[model samples]
Every structure is written in structure tokens, then in C-alpha cells.
Target: MSPATQAMQREDTQNPAMLWIANGQQLWHTAPKDSNGKSCAACHSDAKESMRSKAAGFPRFSAPAGKVITLSQQINQCRSNAQQAAALPQESAELLALEAYVALQSRGLPVSPSRDPQTRQAAARGQKLFTTRIGQLNLSCAQCHDNNAGKRLAGALIPQGHANAYPIYRLEWQGVGSLQRRLRNCMSGVRAEVPPYGAPDLVDLEAYLAQRAQGMPMETPGVRP
Candidate 1:
């Protein structure tokens, strides 16, 4: 990103993602409509205290789900199991807002994906997917993110493809988006078959990314051009 874009992210007032974060804060304290469901705050209490460093350890095994899941998935699980509410749809404004709000609590903390067997296995599958060629272009994620990182592609810089900064305010999208959205964009760019949102494959890839980005500081609500 350019200096100006970086500055936009660093300053909360200038960051567009702050809007989502604010909405998320409101939702955290707001009860579900048409139901006796409790607000997120009712169960978790103060997010700053209860959710601190929580985002760092995502893409972990969920005993209830019996699989590895992302932060967003976990949030939905909490809503369903604890709040007795319906799970929010992927990439929905409300969901993204909640995710952004939760992720914000872990900003500047190190990425710390679980080392459990199931998570590790998912990461292994993701690693294989990362290296395997696919799509009309016959390209792999490693080709651009690993081999050609820092190189120019269609007038844009090819980043190292880290998952540290997410739920970012992408100028291209004109809104906050999740890592899975970004992955879908890449698949489309490569002319590959795009998977549906919340697919296990995407979650597995996220687990791999989390492991790859381990120890990197979280940069939720990041801005990207």
C-alpha cells in the first residue's frame, strides 16, 4: 500500500472500516429481534476484557463443529449455541461488522493458530492446495504469493499473501471484506472454480494462512488499495 493508504488505516478516524467496527460494537450490545435471545455483551461481558487476544487464535478445531473453523464461523457458532439465534450469513454487513469488532480487540497481537491434530491436518491440506496448479492459467497460490511476491502484476504489487490483516477496508470493494472473499477473488482471477462461502476448503486454507502468519501482529480493519 502507498503511504497515504497506510496512514488511512493507522488513523481510526480516517479508516472506513471504523464504521463497521462501530456497528459491530452496537450489535454486540444489542439483543436479537423477535426473540428472548441475549446480546453478545450479556454472555461475554466487556469485549475489550473478554475478547482480548482472542482473534489471534483462530482457524482452530471446534469440538462442537468437529472441524477446524475461522473466527467468523466461531462467532456464528456462539450465536446459535449460546444466544439461540440464527447464524449470520457470510460477508453480510452484520456479520462482517461483528467480525471486525471482535478482530479489533486482538489488534497488534501475534497470530497463534492451534497446533491440534485436526487443525494441523487442515493446514496440510491447505498447503497442498497452495502448491497444486489449478484453473485455466494453471497457476498455484505459491507462484504469485511466494515466488513472485513484491513483483508487479497488472500494475499492482503482489503481496506475500499473509492473513495477518483481515476484515480489511479494501478500496476496490468499497467496504470491509473477509479473507475468504479475497481468496474467491484470486480464484476468479485465475479462472478457477470459485467455492461457496464457508466451504471447508476455504476454512482449511485459512488455517494454513494463520499458521503461516504465526507470530505476526494482527492488523484487523486494515486498508488496502
Candidate 2:
């Protein structure tokens, strides 16, 4: 990123994502319309205390869901099971805002996905997908993000493809977006079939990425160009 962009991200006042964060903070305390008069705050109280380091362990196995799930999925589960509310639509502004708020609580914490057997298996599948060639370009994720990182592609730098900074403000999108959205963008770039949001394969890929980025500090609500 350029120096100006970096400065914008570092300062909360200058960060556009902070708007979503602020909305999320409000949502945390306000009960959903379909809820039984319960908000996230009703159970967890202060997020600063309840949600610390929580984002590090996501894309993990969920006993209730019987599969590996992303932080967004878990949030929806909580809404359904605990609040008796409908799930938020994937990529919705409200959902993204909530995710950004939750992730902010874990900023600077290390990535620490669960070590359960199910999670491990999902990560393995993700690794295979990462290496497998696909689409019209017949390119794998490793080709650009691993084999040719720092090289120019379409006049932009090809980053190393870490998943630490997510729900980020992308200049390209002019808004904050999830890791899954970014994954879909890559799939499209390769002219591959883009999976629907919340697909198991995407969740598996996230599991692998969290493991790959283990020990790295989270930079939630990050800014990128």
C-alpha cells in the first residue's frame, strides 16, 4: 500500500472501515427485530472483555454445525440458536459490520485455529485446492501468491495472499469486504466457477489460511489498495 493509505488505516478517524465498526458496536447492543428481546450484549456483556482473542480461533470445527465454520457462520448460528433470529444474508452490510466489530476485538492477537481432527481434514482439502490448477487460465492460487509474490500482475503487486487482514477496506471495492468475497474475486480472475457464499469449500479454504498464518497478528478492518 502507499504511505498515504497506510496512514489512513493506522488512524481510526481516517479509516473508512471505522464507520462499519461503529455500526457494529451499535448492533452488538441492539436486539435484532426478530430476536426474543435479546442482543449480543445480553449474553456477552462488554465485547472488549468477552470477545478478546476470539477471532483467532475461527474457521474451526463447530459441534453444532458438525463442520468447520467461519466466524460469520458462527455468528449466524448464535443468532438462530440463542436469539431465535433469522440468519443475516451473506455479504450484507449489517453482517459485514458485525463481523468487523467482532474481529476488531482480536486485533493484534495471533492466528490460532483449532487443532481438531475435522479442522485438520478441512485444511488438507484447502491445501489441495490451493495447489490444483483450475479455470481457463489453468492457474493455481500458489502460482501468483506463492511462486510469484511481489511481482506485478495487471499493474498491481501480487501479495503473498495472507488471510490475517480481512473484512478489510479495499480501494478496489470502495468498501469493506470479507475474506470469502476476496476468494470469489480470485476465482473469477481465473475464470473458474465461483462458489456461492458460505460454501463448505470456502470455509475449508479459510481453515487452511488461518493455519498458514498461524502466529501472525490479526489486522482486522485493514485497508488495502
Find the candidate with the highest lDDT and give its number. Answer: 1
Q: How many residue pairs clash per model? A: 0, 0
Q: Which residue ranges in model 2 land beyond 4 Å of their true spot?
A: none
lDDT of 1 by residue, 42-101 (tens): 999999999999999998999999988999999999888888888899999999999999
Deviation (Å) of 47 in candidate 2: 0.6
The residue ranges of model 1 lying beyond 4 angstroms of the native Cα positions read none
Worst 10 residues of 2 by lDDT: 1-10
Error of 1 at 42 (Å): 0.7
Clashing pairs in 2: none
The TM-score of predicted model 2 comes to 0.98
> How does each model score on TM-score?
0.98, 0.98
Cα misplacement distance, residue 91 of candidate 1 (Å) = 0.5
| Model 2 C-alpha lDDT per residue in residues 91-195, reported as the tens digit of each score | 999999999999999999999988999999999999888888989999999999999999999899898899987899999899999999999999999999999
| Worst ten in a row by lDDT for model 1 | 30-39
After superposition on all C-alphas, the RMSD of every candidate to the true structure, in Å, is 0.8, 0.7
